[model samples]
Target: MNFHELLLCEGNTLEKEKGEHVFMQGDSDKSLYFIQTGLLKAYYTSSSGKEAIKSFILPNDFIGSLSSIYAGQNCSFSLVSLETSMLVKIPFEKIVEYGKKDIVLANNIIEFLMRLTLKKERREHEFLCMSAEERYLALIESTPILLKKITQNDLARYLGMTPVGLSRIKKRVQSKMSKQGENNP
Candidate 1:
């Protein structure tokens, strides 16, 4: 069976309101969540209580703590609804069982993992090789809609900069854009 069919057949639906947490750091949640609508934020909280945005989970995305689900360890990050969200929750183990028996299911899982890995890799590259400004520009090109949906502070955190720094960058970008527009005209 296909992944969607599996989810519909075996998954439990949840309607989470804004600010509700799907799972927190150190929680053992072996479930994968398929977002049907709305947005979720996956973030990490340091022991000193600073929060770093890991990524945003958009509609049609699957999110889960891979380490927690596969290694039987505590979750490394927390997931929360940024807006009211509808999701389907399925046990990772259940997916694995089906994957082992169904080639189609196994291929789907592989495809999902590949996409997830590419996203992680791109994020790592952005952190290691790109400046905050460059990352911001890349975010605009790749996920412009996300900028409008998320708060400035959260966007700053995701871009690995302070909110004040982000403000400066935005001003610079806007100034440059206006100049370019004038020049073109």
Candidate 2:
């Protein structure tokens, strides 16, 4: 069967209220979730109590801890609902087991992992090569709608800046845009 068909037949629908956790860092939760609706955040917390956001998951995204599922390790980050979320939850092992017998299903899972890997690489590149202001600009261009949905604090965290720094960047960007707008017209 196909991945979607497999999900329909073998997965379970799970509902999470706002602020609920799908799994926590260092936990052994091993389910892969396909989001149907709502927003979720994946984040890591340092032993010193600093929290860093890994990424935000939107509808149609797949999220899971591969380490926990495939390697018998604990989750490296926590997944939590930012809003009431609907998701299809499937055991990672079950998917792998089915994939062994279904070429299409196996390929689909491989494609999903590849996409996730690319996204991670891009995020790493952004942090390593882009300035804070540039990252903010890219985020604006890519997901402006997300700005309205998330808090400024979360936005700053995602952009790898303090809230104050983000506010300054915002002011600078707006000022530049305003000047350009006046000159253009």
Candidate 3:
């Protein structure tokens, strides 16, 4: 079967409304999901009930399979729709079994996982090394379009900060830049 057809046959198509949750933090280890359209934000809720955005998946982005494929583990995060989303949910067992037989699917899964791993590693490095201003600029530069679509709260969470904290950081950066501009101009 073709990739899309295989996905359709093996998975259930789901439509999630905006602000509606697709899966909770500790849902099930049953199935995986592929994003055919729209956006999803994966997050972890802290002890203080603060939701931190781990990542955002856009069109053609894949999800749910990462923990299953890479760690043989249940989801470490919750997934929620940022907007109305169309997703294909595939059984985890079916994916593991299919990977044994289909070279195309196996390669696709490998490539997708590699990309995900690299992204996560990059974020880890940034978290440990980059300054707050540098991190904010890097995020803005990476997803320039997202600046408008995503909320400040979500962006703050992605940066591992509270909304108020992010606001202060933004103000500090702006003030510093403004002073620099005055000095130069």
- In candidate 1, what are the lDDT values of residues 29-71, reduced to their tens digit? 9999999999999999999998888889999999999889988
Candidate 1 local distance difference test against the native: 0.94
**Worst lDDT window (10 residues) for model 1?**
176-185
Off by over 4 Å in 3: 1-3, 65-74, 183-185
**Model 1, which residues run further than 4 Å from truth?**
182-185
Ranking by TM-score: 1, 2, 3
lDDT of all predictions? 0.94, 0.91, 0.82
Residue 105, model 3: lDDT of: 82
Candidate 2: count the clashes. 0
C-alpha RMSD in Å of predicted model 2 compared with the true structure:
1.6
TM-score of 2: 0.94
TM-score of 3: 0.88
Model 3 whole-model lDDT (C-alpha atoms): 0.82
lDDT for position 150 in model 2:
91
